[model samples]
Target: MKKIKNVRTVALDGLNAIENNQAYSNLLLNSLIEKNKLPQKDIPLLTEIIYGTLQRKLTLDYYLSFFLKGKKKIDDWVQNLLRLSLYQMVYLDRIPDRAVLFEAVEIAKARGHRGIASMVNGTLRNIQRNGLPEIEEIKDPIERISVKTSTPKWLVKRLSNQYGIEVAEQIFLEQLKPAKQTARVNVNKATVENVLELLQKDGLEVTKGEIVPESIQVIKGNIAHSHVFKQGLYTIQDESSMLVAKALDINEGEMVLDSCAAPGGKSTHIAEMLSNTGKVISLDLHEHKVKLIEGQASRLGLTNVETKVMDARKVGEHFQAETFDKILVDAPCTGFGVIRRKPEIKYSKTDKDVHSLATIQKEILQAVAPLLKRGGLLVYSTCTVDQEENSNVIYDFLQQTCDFIKDDTLASRMPEKVAAHVDNGELQILPQYFQSDGFYISALRKKV
Candidate 1:
């Protein structure tokens, strides 16, 4: 079973899966890589192309419009093929123009008509000759950001409403760039220094984490494929995500439950903070997802984590009242904070999705509230930055829930760089704030 070198061909399968089959981008890319068993070099290339195409589709299409100005008609495959090829030519400096077109022509011929292949070749060549059209003439920042960066108009508009033009534009621009590949060193397995030494020895560059002391940011390394990750030496995570566990300020022996734990990033972080002592029940809605928690716990050699495939909204039957010292509702939301990493969300997400997700967040929060013992802590967080999902949710909860108050611990815990944005007992991190995702976290304490 020889691996494939036709990166564009592999990427087209993924693009078509997203465009025609409604598959998620990440899942489809992973599936394509597995099926082809692409060599390590092509993995990043194909991923970058596929995601880059999806990320800047609007801008690519806008540029293509100028190329098609001669009333020269094109078909669906031609359009998609041109979009794919031109993404590399205009945006990616590493791939030479002729190479990108050659691969695209091969893909076009394999999957499309000869005429369409010619169309792709002409459009991409025209792009190289004419250069991309100037976008500064566009007056509206939303449209400008959307056109220049390849984000959707609807998303730019929504973000403008949420964060205003100046900040929202930065977020949109950030989405166009690559994200930091960060990982938290599992203190139980290796110290940050040890992980740094190991990664450096492995011919990789890494940095000490900007936030947590045990956290190490990988500046350049495939930690996932390295022995460091396999040995549970570290777990890939965003620096902003690591803040959730730190904000909790857990001691060595407190019981903590990561409700809705999936692909368990925070669940393991919490366990490490507890020094692998006491209990951490990682609960999710599916057995498959719970396995993610179990996997992380195993990798980190954390014996204290107990994974359960139970819904966070309906876990009362198994646990005693006031059983846990702390409960974390990393409630699922619209994922607005992470749109940069998952750019497809910009096009596919809707206002209705946010409302639906907010409803679930409220339900999960209320259900998990009783699980915490008196004086116990509850940290409600969402990757979204909307008021509806953040402060507003907390506000409505506190108006009636007399036993809990917004914990001021966050004010004291705020990093010097993050303090200016902390407001009214809630930390709303706009992505541009820390080169991180837009996150909302509020600490709540039971009256005791």
Candidate 2:
């Protein structure tokens, strides 16, 4: 890879890769940052350009459409350059319009012919002079929300139908903001107060997490690379995600199963809650993912986590019925919840994806049901706010499985601020509600 000298070019290349290869924004951006060895100061600009462009892609394209009208086709890279430039000019107030225009033209000239550079220059100058097109002009409410928030029309409609239009709009707007960096304190290694003091001593801005009691929000600096994190005193996780282990209500000597566990955030949290006395059988479909679980366990010095590479739907084949005291089905879904962190998901996922994932979720729950002991809790979770993949899936499962009943005490286990939203043992957390990822968690108890 050629060394990119500036953040604009880096941002443009990242955007092109994401568009051409269907790459995830977060993974691709992180890889780009590491490969380029970007200066500490440039990293933030590169991240903002890439994520902001992706987050507001539809709106940026709408602005570009007015300028590109009747023009000959341009290369994807050229379009990406314009999108990133437009993103900085319109959304980022810190960067001046002249600097954005200068960088766009320079990058275009360096990578393309003078003709392409001129076109880029002219298009940007034209926008600066004429101003952006009006999002309000779009008459359809769904279309307006879609362009205004850079969300898909189908998703906007789906959310609006599920949660009223006003709430859906709030969710979309909330996703446009940056995600908070939070870490879960490994109480087995250090108390929350101790970890906060250590992190602050390291010059990181830290504060108590709003929702999960064991979590702390990093107001500044990367906590993942902090000494405390590497010491296994804490693990970086979203505050909403930290709630999973707490919902399980683990005891010291119980046997817990984490179905579809990967990158082991929740699995390790469960292990810590058990105080290393109980065993957490963490399973994922791929060997590489299982290794991730093992790696986290090793780093955290957690001895009670046992990892296995197995399809969650095939758990019954290897384990005896009623073999575990508790089970977690953190089944995969459309991932509509973490849009602020992975903005590409908004465009990449579709209505069909939601329904298909719902089917897979139900299957996973059915396969794991028999493995839980009588009266043992089975917690279901997904990082999505879509009803089809969350509540609807749980509703359908409860209808079919006669042995399991909703655990009404689930709300009491959650933070008091969030407890009121729990209904019939289910909690659907929207991004707007707590400024966290849109997550859904529900609990069921085997009553037979």
Per residue, candidate 2 scores C-alpha lDDT tens digits across 1-448 of 6655788888888999999999988889889989888998998888889999999999999999999999999999998999999998898899899999999889999999899999999999999999998899999999999999999999999999999999999999999999999889898888889999999999999999998888899999988778788899988899889888888989999999999899899999999999999799999999988998999999999999999999999999999999999999999988999999999999999888988999999999999999999999999999999999998999999999999999999998988998999999899999988899999999999996
Candidate 1 lDDT by residue in tens digits, 348-408: 8787887788888888888888889999889988898777788878888888688999887
Which candidate should be chosen as best, given lDDT against the real structure? 2
User: What TM-score does structure 2 among the candidates reach?
Assistant: 0.98
On TM-score, the leading prediction is 2
Those runs of model 2 whose alpha carbons end farther than 4 Å from true positions after fitting are 1-4
lDDT of 1 at 263: 86
lDDT of 2: 0.92
lDDT of 1 at 58: 89
- C-alpha lDDT of residue 269 in model 1: 91
Model 2 vs truth, CA RMSD: 1.2
lDDT of each: 0.82, 0.92
Q: In model 2, which range of ten residues has the least summed lDDT?
A: 1-10
Task: List the pairs of residues colliding in candidate 1.
Answer: none
